[model samples]
Target: MLEDVFRDQWGRVLATLVGILGDIELAEDAAQEAFALASERWPRDGEPDNPTAWLITTARNRAIDRLRRDRTLARKTEQMGRELRDRPEDTMDDTTKLPDERLELLFACCHPALALEAQVALTLRTLGGLSTDDVAAAFLVPFETMSKRLSRAKRKIRAAGIPFAVPPAHVLPERLDAVLAVIYLVFNQGWGAGRVDLATEAIRLGQVLATLMPDESEVLALLALMLLNDSRRHARMRDDEIVLLDDQDRSLWNEQQIADGRSLLERATALRGSGPYVLQAAIADLHIRQPRDWEQIALLYGELGRITRSPVVELNRAIAVGEIAGPDAALELLEALDLGDYRYFHSTRADVLRRLGRDDEARLAYGRALELTAAGPEQRFLAMRVAELLPPGDRE
Candidate 1:
């Protein structure tokens, strides 16, 4: 019960506190304290009728109390406490009356002033309701590193006075790109890690973004892309093994989600959105078809790679290229790009090498990939590949 409520309300409570306190760190502290108190008391007290209002009041009061009593608090926080004390918000009981400031909070987290990594980490910690540890796992960084990064990001926001409000229409497009990137990064991390909670959270946030920016083509396209990719989740793994896309059971795929994603893609196309996300969504749409269009997929990937100049995109293009022009072409493309420390690069190269009858090289590539892979399914799959490349006696 507590976990569910925390997931549902943490963002709202934190956003409201940020609006009131004018400090991300302070807001987070207060929100956490409130939740902690809730955890302690909810079972005994039988959960509040209006949990949002209760949490907001509790967190705000806790922050204000600290600011007033803790002489060590900075003058800025002291001044904030004074201003909050003067406000009539103490008596505001209805959550419906409060403004939903998550959009503002999200935009601030994704502000161009911050580094892209910081933007992603901050947004996940705050708006996505992920723990700092959760963010670190998604980033494949140490907990200490993620903690320091979050601290630096919050300090930067405070030091630079990045406004906690959404940008105006004139600059919204440029700012929107960073927000989209952060959201997609979160989605991909969850998708790759097999954490459905994270993917579901990303889709939920995307839905909110779509509702807010109804006509934004890329926003629609991104949500469509995620849904389309997520539709195959049930079929992507089997008994601790990674199932290849072609080998996945189509019966396990979510037909409704596919339909919804296709509908969104059509809308994005109708809007004439040829942006990176739209292009990718179009590719995802093609991917789910009975006979995968490797040629068109390669062409779309080439276009995506040109726009982003990302080696990962090039790597994907190479996979489609392999289907069209054989292992030699894919191997040639892979060799030209430098994707250091990327697990999939080694795994893909291993597959291409194996297809070319280069067992020795494929075994070496699989071993490297296995060392880098952390996910249970992928790790097992890579290990199996390595064993397959060995002679029967050597395998034993």
Candidate 2:
């Protein structure tokens, strides 16, 4: 129970402290101190009826004490002290205020001035409530490297005086894409690495964004896209192996989530949103149907590709084109793409070559994909294909 509460409320507590104290390091320290106090006192004093409120009050008090102890720090934190002094008596009692601060923290972490990698790491640490070690593991970076990166990002935020608030409406559209990209990256990491907790955290962040920016069509579409994709989580793998989408057990898909995603997509479309997310959600919607319209999927991918000019989108479109125009056409289209380092591109090429009875080329493509991919299930699948393509005498 305590762990669950901490997981859910840690970001809120940290966000509120950062907003009030205007110091990321100070806020983190105070929040950690508050949690440490909770671990000791909650067991003895009985857990507070409102654990979140209790945490905020405790962390705020800790920050005040620390500020007072350091005379030099006192001058620097004067504004923070004043803000705390003037805060409404019931402010700590109101849990809703924490989420508002979390939104502010999200925007601050995703500030355009910060490097994109720093923005992603900082957001995952601060807003996603992930430990530095966890963030490092998620991104496949060394712990010390991630820690230094996070420290640098926080220092930059403080030195640059980046406001802890969402961007103004006029500037939001420009800034919003970075924030959404960070969230989507987080979701994609979870999806690719088979981490359910990370995926859920990303979805939670999406919901928060949707609630904060209800009228933003792209925000709605992003949430819809995540829900639609996550609906297949159960069917994505079996026996610790990757299951192809077509072979997945349809009964395992989350129907409720699919329904919610469809409704959200409808809302986005009603808003005349033809953004990449809305288009992707529309494609995912088609995928859930019994007989997917490959031509329509290909068209939507083309639209998305035209808008974003992403090679990845074009690669996906080629797969859809294969469904509509046969493997040869798909292979021809794919050969025009420059995704030499992308494992999936090679994997797709291998599939198309095998379909066209080009065993030698299929074997080579499968080998390239196997060499590029680190995923165990994907490597297994590719190796199986390579073996199947080899001559009977070379089966060993």
Candidate 3:
């Protein structure tokens, strides 16, 4: 009950604090204190009728106290004090709704002055209401390393005077890519790591993005792409084992998301959008269609590969090529790319090898994949592959 409200309202609460406090680090501290207070009091005093408004009131008071105590920010403290008195937003109940300032938070977090990784990290922290440890898990980095990175990012944002507001329309596109990349990375982390909360949060953020930038083709397409992929969430795993797309039960997929994604894709296409996101959305749409069109998907992946030149995109292209051409063609293409230690490359290679009757090589590829994989379902699936290929006596 309380947990759900915290998850849903944390961003709104924090965003409002950031706007009023005009400092990311300070606003975060205040928001955390406010939530902590809620956790302690809510269970005893009963839940507030307006949790968001209650939270905003508590957090703003804390921020005000901090600012008033700081001689360096005396002017800001006075100004904030006056604004608080004039508007009395902190006193609102059911009559007023908190402004969804998370868009401003996202843009501020993704300011170009900061490093790309910092942008992603900061957005997840504030917008997604993730703690530093959770952000570390998402990035697969050491806790201390992530802590330092986040601290540095916040300090940098302060030092650079990045505004907690959306950029002007003329400069919006330049920063749009960073914002989208941050959101998509959050979604992928959640999807791949089986964190449905994060995935759902990412989808929520995408919906907000679409509402804010209604005519932005890439924004719509990115939302479409995420929705299309996430529609299979329920069917992607079964009994703690990864389920391949070809084996998934269609009934388990979310039809509503599929319809929503297809509609968005159509909207993007109508706007003459052929960008990477639009292209990816188109390919995703093709995949969900019955009697799947492997050729068109392959061509779209080819174009996506050309534009992004990402090895992962090329790998996906090889998969579509494998479906259309054969395992041999896929293997040939896969072998040419330098994928480094990507787990998917080994797993895909192993599947290709298994198909070609190269049992020994396939086992080795599967072993490499197992070494790289940490997720339970994927590890089980890869181990199952290896176990089936082993000689009867050699099996564990």
Candidate 4:
């Protein structure tokens, strides 16, 4: 119970503290101290009636006390003290009128001035509530490296004097893409790690963004894409093994989520949103159909490829082309692309070769995929394919 509350409330409490204290490190320290206090007091006194409110009040008081004790913090304290005094503890409910500082924190983290990698790292750590270790693992970086990167990002934010507020409307479009990308990255990491909590948090944040910018078609489209993908979480794996999309039981898919996604897509289309996210969401919507329109999917991917000019999108388009035009054409398309090091590229090539009965090339491609991939389920599946390609008696 306590763990759930902490997971759900950590960002809200931390955001409130940062807003009040005007210092990230100080806010983090105070929040940690507040949680530690809760750990000690909650068991003895029973959990507070309004846990989030209690936590914010406790954390704010801690920050105020620290500021009072430290001579160096006196100026900041005085600056913030008036506003803090005006906002009473009783008004700290989850739905308090205090503008949700999380959106501000997110925008600040993804500011254009910061390096893109730093922006992603800061967003994941600060807004996603991921520990440095988890963030490092997600990005496949060493713990110490991730720690330094995070520290540097925070220092940059402080030194650069980046305001803790959302970007102006004229600049919102430019910055919003980075925020959306960070959220999706978080969701993808959680999906890969099988961390339901992280995935849930990402969805929650997406909903918040959508609510904050209702007319932003890409925001709605991104949320729709996530909901559509999340709807299949239950059927994506079985007994620790991957279940490919075509093989998954449709009955296991979340029908309501799919409906919601379709509705969002319709709204995006109504807004004349022809951006990459809306196109991608449109593709995902087609994939859920009983009889998928591969030609339409391929066309959408072509449109997306033109918009983004990304080789990855082209690769996806080739896959859809394979469905409509046959594996030979897909293999021809694959050979022209510069995706040698991409594991999925090799995996897709192997599938094409296997379908064409080119056992030797398929075996080599599968080996390359196995070597490149770090995912356990994918490695196991590829190994099984390799074993199948071996001679009858030579099979181990």
Candidate 5:
């Protein structure tokens, strides 16, 4: 119950307070205090009739007190008062208002002035509705480290006088990629890491971006990419074990999300030139479509490689190449690609070698993959793949 409430109301609480405080750092602190209050009161008073409004009201009241307590908070308090007085009462429950607020928050957190890591941390912290602990856990870092990173990021945002509003019209296009990347990481944190709520948080951001930047084809493309990949969440795991794409049960795929992704991708492509996201969406589209075939999918991966010019794209391309061109052909490309630094590079190459009757080479690749990888789910999965390659009669 608490989890659901936090997921849905946390963003609103932060948004409302940020609007009032006009300071991201102070607003976040105020929001945290409001949650602390909820933790203490909810079990006793029971959930509020209008939980969101209750949270907003509670946050506003708390901000008022905070402002009084600290001389530095006075400007924010007056700003909040003006904003509250000028807006309609319905603004408290306004869906439109929240999206715009979040959009602003997203852009602010991902401002180019900050380092990439700081941008990711701030986006996950402010917009993800995630705690410092959760952020630390996601990156497998210590709590203190995550907290310091966030604190440093907040300081930089304030010091640099980063604009809280979205970039100007002429600069929006230039900033769109970073914004999309921030959103993409949010979705990955949730969907890729099995944090469903975080994934939902990411989708919500994408939806807001799509609505706010309707004419920006890439924005719509990002939404399509997230929905397409997210639609497979059901079949991605079973009994705490991960399921590879080819092995997943197609029936578990959500038809609605797939249709939504396809529509968005089609529109995005027709409106503008293809981008890394649009290409990725196209790759996912091929995977989800009925009567799935490896050949057509391989070609999409190739296109994705061209669009992104990323080694990661090349790594994925190797997988498709393994399927259509045979392991020998794939091996030729994979061996030459300088992806050994990446964990999946060795793991994927191992899989290709295993399929090509090169047992010793496969084992060597898996060993290198294991050595390079951090111990995690992906590492364990790679280890299992290694075990599968052992001589059947000699295997346990």
Candidate 6:
């Protein structure tokens, strides 16, 4: 019941109140008051026929009463009360009708006027339904700092009168990228399907977005991508240590998810509306579905390179090109890429050199990767990979 209440009604309750309160902070306070009231009375009332309606109505009345008693807000109180009363009572429905409101809140939180930090905080708070402390912990920041950022963001949204609506269709292409990022961020929280221990609030957020916009290609792509990546989670680690992709047992991957991912990729590309998430999904699909063939993978990565122009994509393309064209050709491509700042680039280059039997170059590349990586799991994995290539029984 708690999960359903939060998943279906929290955003709508917040949005409805925000519309009336004209203040995000006040709206949140009132909505929370409604939630508290539900906690106390729902068990006794045995769940109302329309729980959301009850919450919204109760919250609206609470906000009106509070404002009526505040001299400073008397005019705004009357105005907001009229607005709330005029809104249809039947606006509340089952969770099915609430995704659009949640998506609108996501966009409002990410409005350009908010600082990037505030945007992240507000996204987690309002859309992700996380506490400020949880958000702070996720980012490794102090809770007080996150609280301040969230407070400022909500205040700014009210003060600036940011429209709580989706961007115009003409601007959807650009805006969609931000939306996809937030969804992906949400998905990563509980994305490791096999590892129930890896759950996070991000997963709940992803489920909310998926429920809200199931037809959105980017949403599908993000969900597919996460499922595919997570499908390999068992193979990604062994005995509490990370395993490199090349060395992991492919048989352990979840075949069902791979199939779903493949189908989603086809749909993502069918309309030819290619975005970064779709392109990345295609890349992940290549890795999991067609392990034996890197030609198609290489070409896809090349296209992704043009689309995103991130150095990481170029490095990934080099890996595919190496598998298809030969190590020497891929080495030439890697030479032109100045991804010294990225550890994965060197690790990949090392693997390519090892495949080419260039021991000296491979050793140097491995050393470079080791020097650059901060992730302990990755560092240990690289060391093991590098050790395997050493002369048999060299006893290093």
Q: Which candidate is the best by TM-score?
A: 2
Cα lDDT tens digits for candidate 5, 1-396: 887788667765686667666778878877777788988999998988777776776776676666666666457566666665566667666444543377677788888989888898888788777788887777777889999999998898778888778788888876888999888876776544433366777788788678777777888889999999999999988776789887899899898999998999998989874777877888888877657677877777888778667888878777877777788888888887887688789888888889888989999999999999877666788888888888898688
Best by lDDT: 1
Q: Model 4 — which ten-residue stretch has the worst lDDT?
A: 189-198
- Compared with the true structure, model 5 gives a TM-score of 0.78
TM values, all candidates? 0.78, 0.90, 0.80, 0.84, 0.78, 0.87
lDDT of each: 0.89, 0.88, 0.86, 0.84, 0.79, 0.73
Candidate 2, residues 127-209, lDDT tens digits: the string is 77788988888778889999999999999998999889888999988799889998888888765332336677788889878
Q: If both were scored by TM-score, which would come out higher, candidate 2 or candidate 6? A: 2
> Which one wins by lDDT: 3 or 6?
3
Winner of 2 and 3 under lDDT? 2
Candidate 6 runs further than 4 Å off: 1-4, 86-100, 185-203, 246-260, 389-396
Write the residue-wise lDDT of candidate 4 on 149-195 in tens digits.
98998898889898899889898887898888877877776554433
Please report how far candidate 5 places residue 199 from its true position, in Å.
3.0
What tens-digit string does per-residue lDDT give for candidate 6 at 87-202? 67555455344333666777777677777667766877776656666777776677788888788777788778887877889976667667666656545544333322223455
What does the lDDT come to for candidate 6? Answer: 0.73
Worst 10 residues of 2 by lDDT: 190-199
Candidate 4 CA-lDDT value: 0.84
Worst 10 residues of 3 by lDDT: 189-198
Order of the predicted models by lDDT, top scorer first: 1, 2, 3, 4, 5, 6
Error of 3 at 40 (Å): 8.8
- RMSD values for the candidates in order, in angstroms, are 4.2, 2.6, 4.0, 3.4, 4.3, 3.4
Candidate 2 Cα misplacement greater than 4 A, ranges: 79-83, 86-91, 96-99, 191-196, 392-396
Clashing pairs in 2: none
